[model samples]
Target: MDPQTEGHTGLGDWTPEALGAGRVLPVVSAPEAVLSRDGAEVDPIADETVRLAADLVATMRVSPGCVGLAAPQVGVGARVFAVDVTGHAKAVTVHGTFVLCNARVVEASRWKVGREGCMSVPDLTGDVKRASRLVVEGALPGSGQVVRLTTDGFEARALQHEIDHCAGLLFLDRVAGAHAIYQRKVYL
Candidate 1:
């Protein structure tokens, strides 16, 4: 257990280095069956799980404006996701880069609406209501160590987005109506 994470809610001295040398995988687009199907829970320490975690991080890094990526986005039917809100303007609480397995929201508050886009749904963006403050719990892929994280702002939003993806949801699924969605005007 990370000394910082042991007694409190935050990723203190924890990292995903155990899943080393990740390779960028091809990102799957919308309407793909995997994105619509709920992902399966997996053994966090299993080799395949670790490999997927690594790949998620690698892919997220290369995708422009992609601060978060989930396993199903890469065509894997597993509850794993990677997040890095390091430089996002909307991010208030940054976590650098991390991957979580079978993550779920333990607490959510401070509801707010924000704009969201997806690699899968490339041509559109939508306004979705999500919690601005959040608490999440999940196991780290390689070590299988469970950790709790309390975060707010964009990092929290990113976490919620990936968790939704694992649950077979897209931002489109959460939008108010067709009026809430917008055609993308910029790429990057």
Candidate 2:
């Protein structure tokens, strides 16, 4: 898929080089050391980082039931993630597809309880309380333009989830209690 068509026009110029390097990265799962480690800020303009962002998007597209993915989940300790909630049943705000570098949640409000899961921790899911609305600030890959995204509903949840990965936290860490956690149901 052309990364250019995925919402952010700033990324169009770098998409080719990003995808030119052949190799679809494998998603790192739980018990992997990288998933638990905090990610470092990525150089948004660097070709390598832009390529990684493209790989993240490619990886997320191939993974079933995945609406988002973090660099840590792919064994890269860089503060980057890709999210796309388009067409999701629970999505109230669709962002199409976008990648962020050095992302942070600047504001979050309207807390709500929701079931959360992760690509890294695939075996489990949990009920975690997260903000229903959020304002995220980050640099767009390739362009290095800082962008702020305000969203709510499922899109907000997805953002929070990916941001947590950058901070070395997981849904399991936010689970309300033992009762709040459960074995994941097969998406298929």
Candidate 3:
């Protein structure tokens, strides 16, 4: 269950486990909905957003300690994402699958870098600066529950990082130069 196994292709075909654990993650959105250089909407959320979010949760368990996932890791470019802050599945209030549509970062703090790893860019990790707290807004799956969340600590950082992936940004982009980069020390 070493997610950072060198040369390993992520969770691969691992079986889905728990509410947010599995493999074969969904790659939602085309290249059309991403934001352009001027911050214009290019790739918007679609049917794939929901599908990807479900699969991501399924794949998280196989991900070896994953608590969150983003569409881009699956190769999608939509502003969609999902997360389960509670580390243990039974203790997870949001244990079930979640899908986000047209998500946005409403607020953030100039916090220090947090250790990060990526499913797409596996076998590596680094110190990446992210907001200490985040105010995120998005539409929920099926219920269409518009969620406005204020999250902090690992939960907040993980969510914001994944959302950035949905927006075509990578944790590497926020590494704050070489001084902050590092290799993965451990993987479950």
Candidate 4:
């Protein structure tokens, strides 16, 4: 099973190096069967989620400036996600790519929408409402660490976007309106 062209349930374009580098994750759909609607159980994740997150990292690594990736963007409905806010080519000590399962937004700041985009809906990017900061709680793979992350700035915005996908919501759903949507002037 080549990872690249696999169905929405299969992980695509993922490499081990990408996972270590913090790439973006592909979203999965319901029919793929790798996803379980069960919110917070410790059951094993479908192979699709594992492989997709790895592929997401690989894709994000090549992209100019991606800070997060969600499952829905890949067409899967699993509660899985990944994020790495360390900007491209910047030598910053604060950096890590998080793989999440059955994650939830425990706390969020007042609406502070920021410019957002998605790998799935790549045509248009827009300003969308999101918490200025968030406190997310979820189970980490392997370690079973019930981690709670408090993040803000670009990282926070990205996390919120990816997490939204896990809940079956897209940035389009939160767009202020058509007035706020616009196309990328250049593919930078």
CA-lDDT, candidates in order: 0.90, 0.83, 0.57, 0.59
Task: Report the backbone clash tally of model 4.
Answer: 14
Give the local distance difference test score of model 4: 0.59
lDDT tens digits, residues 18-44, model 1? 679899999999999999999999999
The residue-by-residue lDDT of candidate 3 on 42-138, one tens digit each, is 2223444445556667666466666667655555555556676565432323323344556677889868676887765565677887877677666
lDDT of 2: 0.83
Q: Give the clash count for each candidate.
A: 0, 0, 13, 14
Q: How well is each residue in 14-51 modelled by candidate 4, as lDDT tens digits?
A: 32353344444454433333332222233324454456
Segments in model 3 whose C-alpha atoms lie over 4 Å from true places: 1-23, 26-48, 88-97, 186-188
Between candidates 2 and 3, the one scoring higher on lDDT is 2
Better of 2 and 4 by TM-score: 2
Q: Find the 10 residues in a row with the least total lDDT in model 1.
A: 1-10
RMSD of candidate 4 to the true fold? 9.8
**Would you estimate the TM-scores of all the predictions?**
0.94, 0.88, 0.68, 0.69
Model 2, span 52-170: residue lDDT tens: 98888888888878999999998998899989898889998876788888988888999999998887887898999999999887887877767678899999999999999998888
Model 4 misplaced stretches (Cα beyond 4 Å): 1-49, 88-95
